[model samples]
Target chain A: MTSTTAPVDASTTNRTVRLASRPTGEPSAENFRIADEPLPTPGDGEVLLRTIYLSLDPYMRGRMSDAESYAAPVPVDGVMEGGTVCEVVESRSEALEPGDIVLAYGGWQTYVVAPANQVRRLDPTRAPISTAVGVLGMPGFTAYAGLLEIGKPQAGETVVVAAASGPVGSAVGQIAMVKGARAVGIAGGPEKCAHVKDELGFDAVIDHRDPEFKAKLKEATPDGIDVYFENVGGKVFDAVLPRMNTYGRIPLCGLVSQYNLTRLPDGPNRVPSVMQRILTKSLTVRGFIQNEFVKAHYKQFQADMAQWIADGAVRYREDVVEGLDNAPEAFLGMLRGTNFGKLVIQVGADPTQSA
Target chain B: MTSTTAPVDASTTNRTVRLASRPTGEPSAENFRIADEPLPTPGDGEVLLRTIYLSLDPYMRGRMSDAESYAAPVPVDGVMEGGTVCEVVESRSEALEPGDIVLAYGGWQTYVVAPANQVRRLDPTRAPISTAVGVLGMPGFTAYAGLLEIGKPQAGETVVVAAASGPVGSAVGQIAMVKGARAVGIAGGPEKCAHVKDELGFDAVIDHRDPEFKAKLKEATPDGIDVYFENVGGKVFDAVLPRMNTYGRIPLCGLVSQYNLTRLPDGPNRVPSVMQRILTKSLTVRGFIQNEFVKAHYKQFQADMAQWIADGAVRYREDVVEGLDNAPEAFLGMLRGTNFGKLVIQVGADPTQSA
Candidate 1:
């Protein structure tokens, strides 16, 4: 894998998705636009890459809005940010060469140029290169860091997670099981619930959309919940709070259910119940981003996750939406809980398959 | 103060306050009634005590209701439970002698008997004997354990506490100051707020009842709140939540404002905001009771608190009600923020002052 036909010269050809306007609620196709720009050139200590797989996650909805958040939102007319598995097309740094596969923050573009030090080189022989954008990438790291650092699940403890079929929630349940805790997953509809329990090997699964959701959740957690890895907040959270055990820990990763919520649920406020449950049960509810723990936990996460995949102790599924033109629709579907698993866009043909 | 004279016998008579009925909400005088019982006799391993000071705290409100809580509710016709500064009237064990001041769970009674080992003898020279039930006692330990152990207020961080004129809140603000953090107190009125800032030496004070409470809180916390010692969670908590900085810590200890609420605050549940704020700001909201830290941090609390009071680094105020008969009314007032500081019923004359 040396210099491949002079790098295809992306300097005159680039397709990108830029934010047209912020959404009032759930994002629509009108909020994004397809644009073309002269491809950027690699500067000193940098590499130009062509994206092969673009990952779409629930958090991207947050980046599309100008809300006060842990990270800044994408400015109007700017490229929508995303994680990508890319092949180095042009290299100016000693650390890398053309044809190398690596992970990059390439946004929703077909090509990008970034500092060589910022991307991690990937080995295709060890695992699928596309996983660098899914289970084995940012989403996996999100579950790993949040559960271990904040959730601290112990043996025999009941750990419940909503959005259980998604990348983060699936890993959370499996990792909890590896730690000897009972894993209970909550997903929408029976199909997703069945997949979570039978395929993911969770101890139990409950359908959040069921009319008897609260009763089913109570039945699933006989000893009450000791850890709730919160990815979906709203009705799911309201039901889980009363069921938490004394000294329970809630590692809140994302509130996907409320991401597009324009208004809160109508009723008598539940703040008193939250405060009471916290005090009476001595529960810990901590919200965190994966980057905060990367320095301390990333190395361990990669090693453990790789071995888990190799040994069949852990498994993953990818919902690969085809073409760069379909990314906006796929991203919107992922937020509405339509994606079956880790959602990613097949941006370009994989050159590694020919090797 | 040793066994200088014979113990006064109360074997033939006793005066006590017993729960007449559980209140629907905000316990009234009718819910409590005066009663007489034959003074309890010390058994082989128990000691007889004469109640000198009865400490009334917000937790008693929880015990007076039938609602499930961390601890059991007071049964009808049972003497209301409380922490009391007492004198050993009769000793059956060698650990304590008559005339020694001690801290005991003596309830609302003139005379009672407890296991000798359950009561700890108090040295008058350590501080005032009354303080054994006030600043140097349970309330002090609550503040010390919750702030240092859970809140973990760092130097230059802004720490805020509500009910700032009370024993727990005052100690919380002062201890935060001692830890090199900026302290802000929130009380009910100008008088209590003034005492919290001017007398207790808090860096700033805000009255939660002010019409511009949210604005005032924002002004007081320029860097945003890093640690919130939550004791009176309701409107104060609502106003403070949005102002919290990223990675903020909330040690939820009590909710005095909601203790008397027959119903929750009206409409459009604010739970969504709580979840969203928690996720976006990467906050840590932990609920706890002082007893949880007793095994790990109790010994250190006694040493540090004594040294603090000795060096004039900590000071306390006592809103001493004159008689045991007035306890129910004073307790009710305290819940409404009418009582200023550590409310205690002076059940009997101080035995140490006579010495």
Candidate 2:
């Protein structure tokens, strides 16, 4: 292996954003604490990585809460956990070298010392390194595996996805289209809806904010929905549910809308009605996290997604936040539907983009 | 061809129960109008049958209302629709001979004419002819298909079913035991619970009516539930939900508890919470009607269920309400959970029982 490079930063410190406290409702800046610590020294077979991009996803909100989940919650005082595209600044492993761009769980930090084996090296020439945290990463695999394995959208069937301008939903819609299924997207505003339909090639896009959103969704999906990629659950799910055709399949990936809520909304508990609907329609609602299907579908997803990107069959958009300091606000904005596309925090300089 | 047998009924008229009006909540005697019409002649390819037993099931409640469902609702003033075990009194087709025992959708009528091709002949020698609508029929098939196809209870896993003394739930629990999975039954009364545990051979039984019902269920399913055959969906479901293990499969067949309710229960709408639990646990909640799998698994079900019954590995119970006039009350009682096991209206003389 090439000799390890000296620390590149003039400041011999690493900055991190830690979870100061768990939020009761929507997370605020008070929930996070930014601090500087001595630069971590790499142990044997470990690499020091400088964060280039930090993914801000809806699932991150789940990690912030202490609720029971598929994965453990990010503890208070711990560095806010997230996927990151990093550049290996110093390496002490045969597997990685200095200046190697790799994918790592570097979180909301300027630097992370990760075992070399834990990070997968990214070839910058193949694609922009930022994609290691966006279109070609966890979110993309989430769309691929959940949609295909659970949703199983058949050709000519309608597949509806909410948050259609975001990473997972955008990929879900595009992949549904790839499988010859009609892709109807649900996004918040006119701009995002337009991006979803025109730029992303979705057959139809509904503005969930519009008063006539449900009507528009109904009009868009004339034959009824066969597959629903459920990343957003709240009013959008309420609207899409009645339109589900017999034997419809819903891949429940995330409940982004419910994540921030302090308590359940008052109601005549509609669980019975929902269960009745499922019974009558013979619907399949399966919840899954991306990690469950990684072993079976990750390689295929990479190859197929790469080909789709190259063939112009699948397109993606990125909403890049400028710095680590802006990550909390950007993440909050994402939860509030202010951000569009794959929301990413550009924590540091991107060498690949510069090239 | 065998000669046609004279109509066995003493009266020249067909006595029928018609849906007089839709029930607002609980069905009453007034909802059913018992009427008589002149015996009709069989047309070509039709056979006139004297109903022996009419299957009174939870699904018939759905057919009572005008609500949209998989099958059309029974129109007011129309003969109440049901599955029937019948004896052919008159045959106008070569496929069926007079005195042949057959299964048909003969509705809640003493005597009716049905197309010969639409009915399947049942040999009384193989088992009791009433088994066509009980242990060997729709409810049995429902338990088989929903459990194996959707619930997919793996060996050593826990499989739970409500209404455990009833046809569907009893079969579901027994079949789980046959598959080397632990079977946990939830029933209302101590007698039914005892029957479920001692007679049906379920691994454990919980009395759903007990004050400590939920606690008992939790204790019974220490390993957590992997498969839940959901036929009774109100409080039992609420109790079962928290006990579901990660990747738990729920094959939703019916909502017997909620069937008679006029409106949803007051709540901080729990739909979001349910969806959240589903997402976090990677649960599979599927709604299915037994007929969905009839095409794919019917033959196998027939062979397997028959063998299991013959081997004494599966046991069943029938709550037979004698006389056609008692059917309306019996059906209503079934919705109230008063009837134990498979509720059947003994419409006419059972020739097979005599044999």
Candidate 3:
């Protein structure tokens, strides 16, 4: 609802990353195409936006496939859907005007024109403008909602999150600390693991890449895991299962590790083991999308998250890739755990911050 | 807590069925041995009990093995543990004297001695004395607590329960019906399925033995399952998972189908599919033992169940296998879904009913 306006730029060219093909397993650079577009004029109740930052996430991998899921797959030759921080370059509504910075689902695009009511106006004074699409946006909301609402970590209880250096997992671990619980973060290698432990202030950090990963996990969680914030599901999940204590809660948020799996691994079926463990241990495994709790918890999440950031109780890191041309490669890299922090693309320069 | 008693009968010898050896998979008659011993005498605050009805449940099978579980494995040469409806033969405490019918953990024995405070005195006038260990005791409590507390079947929602002819499953279906939800039962044979749908008044019933079971399930659950009270986990669970709706709740109380298996079945593991469906559908899968809810729900369960039985809003059937000597065969049969209803061993004469 905060705004500052300057003269409108009447002429601007837009660039978009479109899905070029569907992926069978992991996506590749060939699956995306960059296209140039003319400036879109605002219609009634609409605002024309110049995208500043575009978020690249593992979920985008799901949208590229025509598999059965909660959401529909992105069609080949369609703009890849994503969250972006944008500035209003033109306005045709009473609600918004030129130069206003706002958060919009502008996809992997340099410009977007949307209904004024559809975009959330953001103030640069609250935090950095790009945080609107990073920590203070969907990923931050995901961790806040899933952890507190479902994981329900108690004082001194151990809460484990994989992909711990990323946006959602990092926020999850820090928020677990904020809530009086012990946070154990699991990341890919030594660097990310070190960042999770030292910089993020997680009580313990384990590298999934270590040959002694399982044994190290046992050493780290002496009392066993009480809450596992599941972001990656594969070998990491296999390691976490046996370490779960009785009545442990699993908030299944994402299955990043399994998203690229073309077929299930061969086995003496472990599904029965899962059910058996669930039964004998009296555990709770709940899967959820952040929006499920949004109506009930969003306002409170915004207030609490803003306060946590303001008080230094919470901090975040960003892996901001440059140029709209690099989005596809960055996104593919993110799914493979190449990004160290919240991955975002600087689609255009931020008007509120000096270059 | 209520009681009535008469003079003790002092001449009876005790007969017990003990585990002769643990079986690799399905238990056979060779795995059990019957022994004769002198009746146990009450000491101080203890009472001598004559087990009238011995409940045979799927959970009992877990106790027969050395495998790890929530409770300790019943030791080799140990009497098979079970819920029993007993008649107090002698009491040294102020709680009761002789001839008071009660519920006790008397195992597969003809007579047991226990602390008077441990046995719960039953009111035969309110419901049959045998009902204490059948529909009105642990099995009944399992259904009420797991279904309502965990599954949380909303009015008009569809609830599917397998092994639907057994005590736990039947009670689950009836309780789902009581909560105004549509109950779909899955049993092994046409006869059991008929009993489930016709006598039990379940909205629908499918025979898992049918070659067309998967399609039949699809037809039966037109709205998809909102709550799956998982009693038999194997192909039954395989069929149920895909049919689960968004936000579906699964109260996993038992995995009777896999309890006897020594090793897991060969597979391209379906655990990934389980996790995937959970994420995509936003489901809640919780496993619990009924006793966990006893302290909170027992008082209300007793009152509500008694009222339901009195009003004919609920009904139950008993599959009574007479005498302690036949306990092994009846038990092995019960595990294979041979029993039509609540399976009980008639270990002693019921004073309130003629033999």
Return the top candidate by lDDT: 2
Candidate 3 lDDT over A1-355, as tens digits, reads 0111233342566777888889888778888887766787888999999889999888888899998899998899999999899999889998988889999988988888899999999988888988887788889999999999899999999999999999999999999999999999999988999899888899999999999999999999999999999989988989998889999999998999899889988987999898999999999999998879889998898899999999888889999999878888788889888888999899888777876
Q: Estimate each model's TM-score.
A: 0.96, 0.97, 0.96
> What is the Cα root-mean-square deviation between model 3 and the actual structure?
5.0
Evaluated at residue A26, the lDDT of candidate 3 is 79
Winner on lDDT between 2 and 3 is 2
Docking class of 2: high
DockQ of 1: 0.79
Residue-level lDDT tens digits of model 2 in A234-339: 8999889999999999999998888988988998899999999999999999999899999988999999999999999989899999988788889889999999
Checking candidate 3 for backbone clashes, the offending pairs are none
Best by DockQ: 2
Residue-level lDDT tens digits of model 1 in B1-355? 0111333445566778889988887778888887766778899989999999999999999999888789999999899999999988899999989998889999998988999999988888778888887788889989998899888999999999999999999999999999999999999899999898888899999998899989999999999999999999888898899989989999988999899889888878988889899988999999988889888987888899999988888989999998777888888899888999999999988967865
Tell me the TM-score of model 2: 0.97
Sort order, lDDT high to low:
2, 1, 3
Stronger candidate by DockQ (2 vs 3): 2
Native-to-model Cα distance after best TM-score fit, residue B299 in candidate 3, in Å: 1.1
- Any residue pairs clashing in model 1, and if so which? none
